[model samples]
Target: MIQVKQLTKRFGQTVAVKNVSFSVEKGQILGFLGPNGAGKTTTMRILTCYIPADEGSASIAGLDVFENSLEVREKIGYLPENAPLYPDMGVIDYLNFIAEMREITGLERKKRLREMIDICGLEKALSKQIGQLSKGYRQRVGLAQTLIHHPDVLILDEPTTGLDPNQIMEIRQLIKEVGKEKTVILCSHILPEVEVTCQRVIIINEGEIVASGTPEELTNKALGGQTIFIKIKGPKGEIDSKLNNLPGLVSFRKSSEEGHNFYRYEIKGDGHREHCEDLFRMAVDNNWILSELRMEGASLEDVFRQLTAKEK
Candidate 1:
């Protein structure tokens, strides 16, 4: 659980974060998104108590982040954009060192280190030096370090930055696995990753909170965006009038393919799921053959662009 109210940060006259607020429920993977310099990293640093906010307040679980930074640290596992690694230390050895730092000791530390190594698929690189690990393995090692503490919350900033396509997918799967029972706030520029992994999203622009909701909720809240395609063998004007009978109906566009015509209807968001059956019945009554009908929902990328475009 996490909460922030009008959280902001500034450097001199430049505001790095401005009045941004959002919450993450337990076991929820929340996508934290924005363009470059939109305060994602800044906000994350504040939440993790790595940096203090200049104004407003943030709390994790039940304690103020600034007031209880140490307690908050106990509950969070943070992976910054550039995760540190001991170049010469062996992978397992480095992880063991971090384990000891986290106050894990004796058999407990050893067991967690083994589990983390297994979870991150680093068994083959157990004895390999950190510098010998490839970039992807290094990222996993960073993740392993974050999980070695067995934290309740994970704050990952650009977790999959330099990996290839397969590597990215691998990391995303790893994130999904780890997010099962842990609260996670993942900051990423890649739209698909968020769409795939996050149940809810918070979009920030120019340090202000622009949008926050489930992907579907935010997309549907965008008014004036109902478009349905109809494929039927009715005379053009007749098919057009039939659809126009609906409430809040707008103009319809007609296109032809072979002998059939497509009547594309643009209407208000009228919660009209039943319109499909009604339209089919009318088509049959008029002796018109029906072929295709479907609703086109807005893509997440489109929503993101529309929500953030005003910053320009």
Candidate 2:
């Protein structure tokens, strides 16, 4: 439902985004990840028509964001990192104002307001002033206003900022539910949140897209192979010999030494479960005690670091 091609933006001599390109399918939740000062917010602003790009093009549902800015805005709901809110207005009043601004009036306006209150879990805070509500509640109010117009696309930047663990989970669930029908572009610094909630991810660094893929695909690409952690009780020389001879073993390193007999080892090899089986068989053949053996796959955080880390 969204497409960007060769998009570039600059401020003075600084390039904020450079030839960045990606697409999001209808009803898909895409995670946009980057380190600080990576132009994430700048890109979002361009997509929302809040700012124009210096070069290239972006479109929402086939409407050019620059040429058809008004129409594009109609199809998009944007919740910026810091939600714009009036402190003195009551929660309900604030939402009602948003509804009116969206041209929703009378029965439809009241219905949408009630629905937002229910969907955002704002019933208890509706009568309270926005400034009196907790940060989490204020975030909910922001989300409610964004949804008040039922836009086809939701662009949320740091949607869970300032939220407690429980509130974060609640908002994640809500986003997932909303994503069942609407396309969503979520920007977050939390790797685990993006890993768990998004269908696909685009990682950007130095104003350029460094990687894009499913979580599992990116993880595998980052790791290059599987990592096996094993704790065994055996003679050090014998164990090393056996491990060295194991098929598909690319490298091995001693992680820790537990007493004189037990040792912890991390083995890297071709990503396959058979490697673990091979380790167990080798231990049994040598009459060595196998205390622990488990395969560890690369996490999203690993992929993030691999892609965004500064080159030596």
Candidate 3:
């Protein structure tokens, strides 16, 4: 539902985004990830038509964002990092104002307002002034205004930034539910949240597209191969010799030596199950006590660091 091609943007001599390109299919939730000053917000602004790119093109549902700015705005709901809100207005009144601005009136507006209140869990705060609400509730109000128009695409930047753990989970679940029907572009610094909430990911660094794929795919790319952690009780020399001769053993290192001949080892290899089996067989044959044998795969955070870390 969204497409960007060779998108580049600059402010003075600084390049905010360079040759960035990616696409989101209809009903897909894409996670846009980057560290601070990585042009995440700038790219979102351009996609939402809040700003124009200096070079390349972007389109929403085939409508050029630059040429058809107004039309593109109609199809997108944008909740910026800091939600634009009026402190003095009551939650319901603010939603009503947004509805009016969106040309939603009468029965249609009423229905949408009711739906947003329920969907955003804003029933108790409707009568309260926005400024009086907690950060979580205030965020809900922002989301309500964004959804008031039922836009096809939702561009949310740090939707759960300041909320407690419970509030973060609630917002994540809400976004997951909304994503079933609408295409979503979610920008978050929280890697775990993105891994759970988004179907695919795009990582940008230094204003360039660094990586793009499913969370698992990116994790595998970062890890290169599987890692196995094992804790065994045996003679150090014998254990080392067995591990060194194991098939598919890429690398092995003794992590620590505990009391009573127990040792912890980290082993890296190509075939995951094959290596585990070899370790098990060796432990049994050598009468070694195997306490822990587990596979450790790369997490989204690992992938993020691997792709975005500064060059040495």
TM-score of 2: 0.90
- Model 3 alpha-carbon miss at residue 74, Å: 0.6
- Residue 171, candidate 1: how far off, in angstroms? 1.7
**For every candidate structure, what is the RMSD over all alpha carbons to the true structure, in angstroms?**
2.5, 2.4, 2.4
TM-score comparison, 1 vs 3, better candidate: 3
Candidate 1 per-residue lDDT, tens place, 1-312, comes to: 899988989999999999877788898999999988888888988998989998899998988999999999999999988898889999988998998899899999879988997899998888889899888899999999999998999999888888899999999999998999899999988888888889999988888988888877766655445556677776777766777785544445665455435444433444334555666678789988777777666666777888777644
CA error at residue 57 for candidate 1, angstroms = 1.3
| Per-prediction TM-score to the true structure, in the order listed | 0.90, 0.90, 0.90
Model 3 agreement with the true structure over 163-193: per-residue lDDT tens digits: 9999999899999999999999999999999
**For model 2, where is the 10-residue window of minimal lDDT?**
216-225
Model 2 clash pairs?
none
Q: Give every collision pair in model 1.
A: none
Model 1 residue 298 CA deviation (Å) reads: 1.5
The per-model lDDT (C-alpha) reads 0.83, 0.92, 0.92
**For candidate 2, what is the lDDT?**
0.92
- Backbone clashes counted, model 3: 0
Model 2, span 166-258: residue lDDT tens: 989999999999999999999999889999999999999989999999987788667767798999999998889988888888899999999
